[model samples]
Target: DLAAAPGVGVDRPRSPQPLVTAAPRADLVIWAPPDVAAALRPRAEDFGRTRGVSVTVESVSDVRSALQDVTAPESGPDVFLGPHTWLGEMEQQRVISRVTLSRNQQRRLAPKALAGARYDGQLWGVPYAIANLALVRNTDLAPQAPQTYEQLIANGRRLKAEGKVNRILLQSTGSTGDVYSGYPYLRAYGGGIFAKTPNGQYSPGRLVLDSPASLEGARRLAELGREGVIQPDVDNTNAVPLFGDRHGAYLVTGAWSVPVIQASGVPYAISPLPALPRGGKPVPLLDVDLFYVSATAQSPKLAQEFVRDCATRRDVQVRLARATGLPPALTAAYRDVAARDHHYAAWFDAGRDGDPVPSVPAMQAVWGPLGQAFADIVAGKDPQHSLTAAARQISSDLP
Candidate 1:
């Protein structure tokens, strides 16, 4: 396990050997997913206008593999545009360098956005956008958003009984289980994958998946399965269509589903998940998109300059947020985008109420086991046994 392995999760901050300012020499290359690359293409030249360097945006299909190539000398892009979740592993592998943000620059970003850009007690990237799941309701069918989880379930059941809808809620669990999409439900029952310290940071030393509260959450999952409210067959590939076609009344999804929902021409409303009748809050996981400087970049300072100065500009972040259908990370940029689109504001608000997905390398051990535990519970297995087994497996797998 990377956490227990020496040097992975340790809070040892290495000085960011900042390069001396020099004349721009080589062109800086940035690798991003196709959609993001498209959005940056037109703005790439603007980033280098005053630096006397050219910026090139390259489309990469798989960011994971691209990140791996950063370790090979002269084989990868000088900068990587990807998710904040990669921070732990990249920092551990020594493929990425820490980002040095000035006090003023740090002040310009949202606290959560800045926090998400850091791992192992150091900032490692410049975050540009934030994304999180929200309760998406087909307004025509549901009319009004439910005030509580019980009301959501009761309303869906009534609609199903009346032949108005075929499914209760359209959340994607799939055959393998998706802990990301299923998290709100688990959280509603007081289950969490990791325990948080008093400071509110995830503690790798504490794995809470098998605690009494989590087991109770697992039981709730099984109950939902038995009632056919959540199914092992429904997944991301079809959940949007099912919801868009009016087969489901509500969908627990992120902004990625927006374009499809809009194309379907459905009158929909986005809001926070309703309160649970019991106690737990249905807070979704926050996912931040960031631009990380490569440790082996030929022009490290130039790369940092671009990310810190150009990319973090309010105008630049707003454009990226619009293209991605996510909320900008910059506090000022978010306000500008939120004013223009209320859907963006809804997602931004949801992220504010959510927790950042744990970025520790230890999180790598949680997904598979926890996901299987959820899948088994949904497949008729005993919740207590499945959860206990999953926790045991995760413990054994952790260093």
Candidate 2:
């Protein structure tokens, strides 16, 4: 496990950079996923005119692997935008560069975004979005969203009995299990897989998967499965189709599902993920997306400026939010966009309510066993015994 470190504000970049102005026709390359790529391409012309550098926004699939291949200092894109959780491995591999944001710059967005971007006491990127799982109910079918998991399941059972639906709620999972999907329930039951340090950051060395809270959470999982509330066969692939065809009354999913749900013509409303009947607030894993400067950038200063623009500009952030159907990282945009769209606002609130998973090396060990433990719980295995064994394995696997 990584040693507990100070709050995010040290480890400045060590590169010896020479001053080089952006040439009139110089290229400022940025790589992002297809949706993000589309959002950026339209702004390239305007950004280029303001910065005096021609911008190139390229779409790349599986950016994590692509980022690995760009270790050479002269060839990679100057900036790459992706999940903030990749900071540990990417930094160790020297695949990304560190960034220093002035207080004024930091003031442009919410503190959560800044906290999510920090790693080993330095900011590696600038966060622009926070994603968390929430409950989306087809209001036309279910009318009211359930405030508790039991209510949701009971509603599902009734819909099935009435011959109006085939399932109550469908969460994406498989035979192996889904740690991400089950996180909220684990948190709600008072058991979390990891503990937080004094600085409010995830502490990898402290494994608490076997805590009293977690065991209760496991019991809930077992109860759901044994009662036929969650089916082991429903994975991400089928969860969409089942929900799209209006066969399910609700979907426990993230912001990414908004576009598809809308396209399917379902009357949906987003709600805070329901709590446990035993008095647990549903706190899901918060996934923050950031724009990182590459260590290989030919013009580090220019790259930094571009990153600054991406982080602080309302127009840029709002455009991306409009394209992605997810909430913007800027609190300003959150309020502005939310005023017009309640769905986006609900997700933004949910993100603020969730806990962030640690971006540490030790976390890699927990995923395998924790997932299996969840799968076992949902497969009728004894929750107490399964969770105990998994917790033991996690403790032994810690670095």
Candidate 3:
């Protein structure tokens, strides 16, 4: 009936300007985890000055739970500052939209940082910080950092032999060894969960983690258990406490474990994961911290403009790094901190040695089955058979 109204047409509306300008400038609410709330709260004024939109900083108790219903504008954030790994799940829910960047803008960020949130060729989140796994050695127990995996185990063996420590090396992992923590060893043998094309795009359809090369990596892990360097059950439960209590001379983990290590009163040094003895390099897991825009944002345009302009500003990014001591993702911001801090510089270099974790939804398949296989390997199962079974399980799980 309205199609026949006077001065109205079936194919056209009376005015197109409203549709073009539907998203007006409005206040913004940024939801952030407690640790980084102070880092982002100060930007409220900056966003106001630049985008003419006041910002309210809300403390998120649980980052994942807080973002679960992001399609509801009244409750969800205009923007969210959290881990980049959430991008896949969020995008699948259609709760977040890709924040397109220009060529020059893309150049400002580190490639891996961008890759963590990038999926299907779209940069869905604007990255701010990077955290990756590396070798954290207790300088008190081991005066020098290990230059190779061989060196690391050698030191641990001597310490255990000397009755100075119970475990040679300590790494926090799940029962089967955490894939994230064990990735460096797996990568050392030219194996990983996903294969990449020449251009470095992940072809999830072509998984490489269960390939023959991966079997070699699995054998190495099994060797650790057979040599008594680490017991089959020693991995997940006690690594953090053991490392903190001076029971572990060498630890393979990320910055997230640094504070507990420090509080233990142990002298430590941060270094990249060791190079493989056979001309290979261990690649650690690199996780990015990102700022995401909600699709349900009332001021969608202003939210994007704030993320693009104010949030990525060098000053803001630098302050974020200083507050958290995490490496900044902005290339310029990282350079500034790397010049001033040795610890931060080591982490930056370590991340460069590793590849980004695939952000595809199917990446979920690589975890449980693969982790169980790695556990079985260390428990005296045949590495080749265990890995083969895990790969078959992964393939079956995928469409």
Best by lDDT: 1
Tens-digit per-residue lDDT, 1-399, candidate 3:
001211111111111111111134338877776667677778766778675557776666555555653445666678878766566766887878889777787899988888887877788889999888777888878888788878988888888888888888776544655666656767787988888888787898997877877766777877876876646565544676688888878877666666677788888888888777666677877778888898898778877987888777888888888877789999999989888988888888777867776666676677778767766777778888887888899899874
Name model 1 segments beyond 4 Å from true: 1-26, 69-72
Ranking by TM-score: 1, 2, 3
In angstroms, what RMSD does candidate 2 have relative to the true structure?
Answer: 6.7
Every candidate's CA RMSD: 6.5, 6.7, 11.0
Candidate 1 accuracy as lDDT: 0.78
Cα lDDT for residue 21, model 1? 18
lDDT of each: 0.78, 0.75, 0.73
Local accuracy of candidate 1 as per-residue lDDT tens digits, 115-161: 89988678999999887888899998888988787888999999999
Indicate whether candidate 1 or candidate 3 has the larger lDDT: 1
- 126-190 in candidate 2: lDDT tens per residue? 88787778888889787887888888988889889999888767876577677777777788866
Q: After the best TM-score superposition of candidate 2, give how far the Cα of residue 127 lies from its true spot, in angstroms.
A: 0.7
TM-score of each: 0.90, 0.90, 0.89
RMSD of 3: 11.0
Q: Lowest summed lDDT over 10 consecutive residues: which window, candidate 2?
A: 6-15
lDDT of 3: 0.73
